[model samples]
Target: MSETLEQRAAPAPDGPEQVRAAPIGAPVEGSADEQLPTPTRRANPFRRALAGATEVLGPWARVVWAAAQPVVAVVSGLGWVVLGIGFLATLAGFILGWSELVFLGFVPLAAILVSIAFLFGRSTFRISIHLNPSRVTVGERAIGQVLITNPGSRATTPTRLEVPVGFGLAEFALPAIPKDGEHEELFAVPTNRRAVIPAGPAVSVRGDQLGLLRREVRWTEPVELFVHPETTRLHPTAAGLIRDLEGLVTKTITNNDISFHALRGYVAGDDRRYIHWKSSAKTGQLMVRQFEETRRSQLTMVMTSDSRYYGDADEFELAVSLTASIATQVIIDQVPISVVTDRLALRTHTVTSFLDDTCRLQLAEGTFDTPRTFARETTKRLPAPSVVIIVAGSQLEAQEYRGIQRLFGPDVNVFGIRVERGARASIKDVAGMNVMTVGALSDLSKVMSRAL
Candidate 1:
């Protein structure tokens, strides 16, 4: 009985220790929770008020910013001056504590305001630009006309029009135009270089008398001027070792052929339709038509864009001119010619289009295989042997050309024209290939005259 009473009165083993330890709900000093750094962001009434105001005014601020972007883009050099002067005047007024200078600051401010008002006004004239003969040769002239028409019922204001040509700008002062009147300005485009010149959307800039705060408005669309490579006159028949109209003809007989080559003594199985009665009566023997076996009358012109083959940029230009001259002459003669350049090929259709395509041709960026290989690969796909003409730089080796000859395989009359710096234009026969080296563009016609 005493043992049962002592057991009930005494505390359990863990009861005292559990009571001594604080409950989870009670806070403890120097715990992990207390040791951590406080968060940088804390609730602030002032910041909350500012954010609430910003949310309220966000749409109006966005509207103002949207209106300012175009004005910033159109601002000219004088516009920047007005802005800087106004800013410095305001700053000086605050620093010096002078009321007069503060008012003086309004001078530039008022000038800018007036300039903005003038520039942002509605355009008074409609502008249109036309490029006459949009495609021209390198040395030919391209005419540009900017026509400004006053379409409004009232007289249009005098303004300045600027058009971008190549890398420069052409400016003109437009006189005050009557209602429903038009003014045209004529300008000559520089065609010294072979390139595509971009003539722009006419920009009309209106500014203050003090040259402050100008507004530029685009009034027309852009036009491209394609400057073609210069080419000399080459006679159609003066192509290469072979004649233009006929290829290599063989001594063969055919009953039906387009070309009347010759009449031959009639043999067994001769077609009666081909029997020449006049020749038979004169020779006292049956005569029949014999057609000369002819190769295909197709000319293949291969051009290389390999920089290694050229000694300088001038050499490349001469090569292009030579290619163009030959290609033009062949096309003019109505002989089907295939032109293969480094980055382009021409489908000999129109002289104008061909020249335009040649103008667009540019040299390849990296190294490439021998142009002869390219020529052979291109020729293999053709149905018949062609008179192959290759135009390249002078850096090519004899073995490389021999490789080109091997690539053409057989039956192709291959001709090469190499342009080099500090060299005279002359022709040479290299390993059964006729090659001409030309240093100048004028000598092209001379060389062809000698070769053909």
Candidate 2:
């Protein structure tokens, strides 16, 4: 909800309303609903109104009276002499002892009726607008539609109505209704970008026989459209295992690999399948079948997004992109990565449902915001055993250095990536850990290829 109507009824000390808002078309308490902006067709806005009176009056219906204003003044001026004649007739009626009042009243009554007859169309109508795909995937198309209906018993006057389009939505106008009737139209929506698309409003004017009295009716039906950013592909290849970092892709199966660890001596209650024949023959002791550890590998990913050039959009957007890519990779690789952030889960482990769309995310200004996000998130968890990578700004950072050592442990490698604003970023190792960092988005393909 925006500010209350009372607060916005007038300008404040700051001046006019900075953000523009469309007006409500009907009463708020009415059954009418809000119009969502959608994509649709284009119709010429200035078409003329089409009423029975318009056909009779032709193109000059609205202006006929105005165009003939001078002639009307002349005629009406001469008609004043009829008032004198009426007075004399009334005087004569009085002198003849007949009623004078009736004679005087009929002249004025006839003149009033003639004046009313000059006015044209007399129908009432309502306009309805609709927007489709109220919500959309990034880059998906949205649509809009407009409907006009005459809600009267009598036919209409010659009228032209213009509907506004495109603040974020498009607008169209319809011609006047001859009798009671309907009209429809369309337009387009820009995809995946966040914006407040608004359609201007409509303009309708009614004509009279004299054309002197024109009624310009303004309509305000507002619609808003929102565009989310598109989904992009991530690094295709797995990263090479860095001796220093936590998350590296390596082929060698060991205590660290997600595969089988080894076989051991069988104990009481051990299943018969646990006995190893070859090892039993050599050592004269039974060895149980070895299996890989089912436990999830511990992972910690730190991102410092303060690039010298990363522009001002949504800090959270980039954070989300990076987090989604990394988190998904961890799950796919069979590693359980935990994300650190404030105000979310105190701790995330074992790649639970929490990691799905809600990857620990934080968007802020400056380099420390990244580390701050991490420090704030990992409150309850034990230290991790898998690789640790810190993706930060292109510039050297203090927290990156401190965070690496603070989170460091056995077999843990920490790596850093520096991103320059508006330029290609690459993954590079800042600490002894294989911490991979990139400055440019263009180099993403090359960096990703190495992992494959």
Best by lDDT: 1
Q: Pick the candidate with the highest TM-score.
A: 1
The superposed Cα distance between candidate 2 and the true structure at residue 70, in angstroms, equals 43
Compute each candidate's TM-score over C-alphas: 0.67, 0.44
What is candidate 2's lDDT per residue for 1-452, written digit by digit as tens? 11111001121234222222233221212110112243222221222122345567767775765575433332232244444466666677677766656577456545534644443444476766566764443446555555667778756554555443332222233455645687655444443333334443554555333433334455545654444322334554543331223333333333323355577787887778557789899989987765543323466665443433234434334443455456555655565566554334423444334333242233344434555445434433645545555545435464455555465644444544444444544443434434344433445445555523
In order, the Cα lDDT scores of the candidates are 0.67, 0.45
TM-score result, candidate 1: 0.67
Candidate 1 stretches greater than 4 Å from native: 1-68, 77-111, 132-135, 209-212, 235-237, 240-295, 367-385
Residues 1-452, model 1: lDDT tens digits: 00000000111233211112122223322111010111111123433444466567888855765676565554555556667788798889989998888888878888777776667566678888888889888767667777889999888788877776544456677788899998877666656556666666688888876766566788877787778788887654465444545566545545676667887888898889999999889999999987856665777787887777888766777777888888887777777778877666776798888887776666565445656566666666655545777788888775566677676536567778888866887888887777888887788778877876
Model 2 score (lDDT): 0.45
lDDT for residue 421 in candidate 1, whole number 0-100: 63
